[model samples]
Target chain A: MLRSQFHIELNNMHVELDKMCHLVIEAIDRCVEAFQNHDLELAQEIIRNDKAINDVERSVESKCLSLILKQQPVASDLRDVSTALKVVTDLERIGDQSADIAELILEMDEKDSYLMIEHIPSMARVAIEMVTSALSAFHEHDIQKANEVKKHDREMDQLFEEVKLELVQIVKENKDHVDLAIQFLMIAKYFERIGDHVVNICEWVEFNQTGKVNDTRLI
Target chain B: MENKIVAKNVNLHYGSKHALKNVSLDIKENAITAFIGPSGCGKSTFLKTLNRMNDYVENCKIEGTILLDGEDVYDEKVDTTVLRKKVGMVFQQPNPFPMSIYDNIAYGPRIHGIKNKRELDRIVEESLKAAALYDEVSDRLHTSALGLSGGQQQRLCIARALAVQPDVILLDEPTSALDPISTLKIEELLLDLKDKYTIAIVTHNMQQASRIADYTAFFLVGEMIEYGQTKDIFSIPKDKRTEDYITGRFG
Candidate 1:
């Protein structure tokens, strides 16, 4: 087979993997919106519907692994599949983490006032945007965009630290809210980790395309 | 670090076929350099050239020079036997001699006329210990080397090479035939030996190359595609062919 044909096939598979990333991100986005509005019904529904995102992660992983094992994909193709594998693993964990937050949302009653309600959803949005843009960079093979993702991760890290501080203050003020605040803090931390993972995936995309692995912030 | 054996503009041919084309590599003293590529890519052929093992093959001709410790190994005055003694080799399969472990370790030393039993015993013990296997087989040195496990046999072969006290050791897919545990043992042993012996290994396993080698040379279609530090080669290979091969594109 011609090299161009092999490359075209790998490009097609890359698009499919990108679509899978989109699916999981959209799922997490939905859960984020649900948790923000204290919509227990919607949060519960998102928790119940997480299987679809999980399924995409599995399918994409299988596709990438098969391409690697069978086609012996060349430079860019190998990078794409390897990045897809790591990204899907990260996205899958994000899906579960979002579900965890949704479960917390389900337990809280409608009347309870969150310690840092304003910060949590906004933090989630930033985290989601980080993943979204990182995936966009990967899909376009844009190193500049990946670098932007790295920059925005700083915001997520700062927000995580702020939230941690606020939760600590709330726990000290009212021990009754300690459990809820701790759970919320864990959710925020998971989102922060998700952001970090997205940055990692972006680094892989750069490494795949340029053969360079960039060192990014851990948080 | 300066290379003990340096190959400059090296090329090789097997009959009408080119096996290596313009491959220039520097293997540092007391460092492990791994050559990785797909099958039939001339990694083994290149490894064989270091000690002129290809001299045994008919119609196999080489161009360019290989230097050993700043001296030309391929020089007409340099005895191939003497060169082989300075550069020891271990093959893919552990072809232990059809003799006991004692004889296997003693074979080369004995050929060189080291007849003192006490000295031979010390060499055997030290070589086996250097290969990290003295304690397991010190009591059973009289047993046939083949009777040991595959990993132990491979280590015994390493001990045999160490007994010769070579300056450089070439491993041609030495762990390819062994189990995972055996592969790990050999890898660990190589790591330990790197501080004392200049080691060159040809392997198809990229992870192995990354794990143990200080320098990695990627070969493709009888050409040196890229050669660099292992971290740089794995993380950011300059050549597209290198990136393709290391990331598991083609064999």
Candidate 2:
């Protein structure tokens, strides 16, 4: 290798990004579990762990800046570093949105049966799968897999619409359930946003692979 | 943009050793084209061929067609002196003729028989201004060219090249010997000069190539590996060797 130190530093950055992906994925998974079971303790734990994801983002950002300053990477190396810089922002947002869902879970009334709506949990499951698949596409450098993740977002959006309609029906039947329905709506919206973040991550993956986003060349 | 120089199937040999193998490309008019590769990759040899700088080498054999403004550069009827006047060159180091700065810029015009003091003075000032060095050295025109900083010397050399009114300027690693600020000044000067003169540079600095070059060609082991727009060449190179070379994975 011509630039062994640069390759090592780039590899370390990739490992850190992989770590961040897992951290965000775990936060989303646990937040959904906490929401499904109304586990306040787990929800609070997820919120606290969000700091770790943010710290990883900071580490990746610093490493990227160092690579750019020290290595002056070009071609695919430039794309890789720039994509990592962009991917971390989306990953950090995914972490924050997961924490937001955990906070919403904490605000849910104990007597409410919003979990019975069913589609919200399904949305959470699809969101987690989308995030996992998207990061896998990133780590694998698979554009086809990234495209698959994008296709999965459509399923997430569909589930979100179903949840929105179900919540509206519940609120229409009984005005007393309006407060809990709003909470459920917020939770579904968070998952939908997570799906969007996963899609963004996939787009970065495509850029890392092809140097284009949505058919537009960025590099 | 029209092509200022077109080279087709150019091959060169220094005795028995092949230096450049069938290299071909177009140097666009009023644009910067950068040739880049590792040392011994024939990038410099190829650049030298554009101006026939290799004609002095012993046992050197060249075969190819090189056109400057649609005229064959190798035609026996062509005057090399006039060819060189139209195709000026600057070297890697700032080889300012150990004379005063004013004389340095005026040397080319003087050699071409422009002896009128007023005309030489006008050419000196205009070339220095065109090179972005007039403000720094206008008061010190009589100072020794060697006394200037490395970057200033390089710009002075460029000014000397420009004093002759060349249609094309060829720079061989123009900023390799300078500091960052000087290098940036040279880069900015080249960017500005591209509006009037065609520029072909052979650079070891890939960032400099990506920064100022509108078109880039990557050479490897005497072969032209890839050629394209600077943005695509630096972002998503088509050839894997070009990618590996640019990304510093291997060269």
Candidate 3:
């Protein structure tokens, strides 16, 4: 309680980061839904809202810089500020990947019939769950939850491979299906990259909690 | 590195007030070890003990073994003058003597019976250069020490301490009274000095400790609370009390 003003500013920064996490999570959710139902309007909305996540990232980054310059936090306070700075990068990238998926969904031909591919949606669901859990782990400071998110990434990778093989089979069955299959493949890859971003976020959560990244102490 | 100074089960009392608990730590050879805590935490009291500066305090009682180079410093037969020469000290303020700068640097050597003028001049020049103050004041060596700026005076005090070529240097808030640039110069000088002398500092500035110390010890209420590598202590301190203090959450 000694540095109450510093604590207040640090808490405000945490709140801003939390808000950014929520925005990124929503983008992932809405983009997946838009991809599944072929809702062009919702896809456009998610793409537009990606800017909000970027703005929050910039705001949180500025707060962290100010806290470091003015308060000169050390120990866990230092770790928290550094982790926030790194986490926002991953969160912003997650938002970008989600927006990229929405863009790919918008590029789908109206008569493509690729929406029948079940594995792509499954990958999207898993990616969304991993992202939610990773950010939650950061907010809650739960290393166990962060580790679980890391483990879940393997499942995401497997789903991506399945989607790739399924699309390849559809293209082999009919050369005319190549265009739609390739678009679906690109969407699955975006989800896969989102999974990687979630893993990075989880790593940063571990760093905030334990001051280590991938079992190596950074300080 | 080897243990240049080892203090074991050290306790001190000024009359009925226990100023230091059973403190024990090793000052590594040729490395900067910083002691940090809030005011009146006995960090300076403990620093004074290293050079037996507390012997002058009335009603002071000390119980411990302080070893310097494997020899007990408190042993009755140990010459206090020689022991003091081996463990020189600097105070919080820039306490330069009211004499010329050349005499201030030459005072300790003169006391130790070095009367040769050429030898004294060499010692003065080497000490000033070692303290990183030679270039600015070499031409004004005979000028009064008090006329120097606050930062320059502090470094001159450091030069005075270095004139005798002590094996270890103990500083208590050496830069608290100076400007930021002066503080940084002293810090840089300490970093450079560690190659030839073991250094222990007592400071209230946690950032200063983190910046220059190879090792850091946190003291609290006459007790040594925690000690470790500076990186580990500042990043992931094992004790919550230490974490609270370093993070400015301690009341």
Candidate with the greatest DockQ versus the true structure? 3
TM-score of each: 0.70, 0.96, 0.98
- Model 1 lDDT per residue over A124-196, tens place: 8897788788878877889888988888888989888888888888888889988888778877887888887
lDDT of each: 0.83, 0.92, 0.92
Question: lDDT, candidate 3, residue B194?
Answer: 98
Candidates 1 and 3 compared: the better one by TM-score is: 3
lDDT of 3 by residue, B90-143 (tens): 989999999999999999999999999999999999999999999999999999
DockQ of each: 0.15, 0.77, 0.90
| Model 2 stretches with alpha carbons more than 4 Å out | A109-111
* Residue B42 displacement (Å), model 1: 1.2
Docking class of 1: incorrect
Which tens-of-lDDT digit does each residue in B8-54 have in candidate 2? Answer: 99999999999999988999999999999999999999998888899
Order of the predicted models by DockQ, top scorer first: 3, 2, 1
Question: Which TM-score values does chain B get in all models?
Answer: 0.98, 0.99, 0.99
Error of 1 at B189 (Å): 1.3
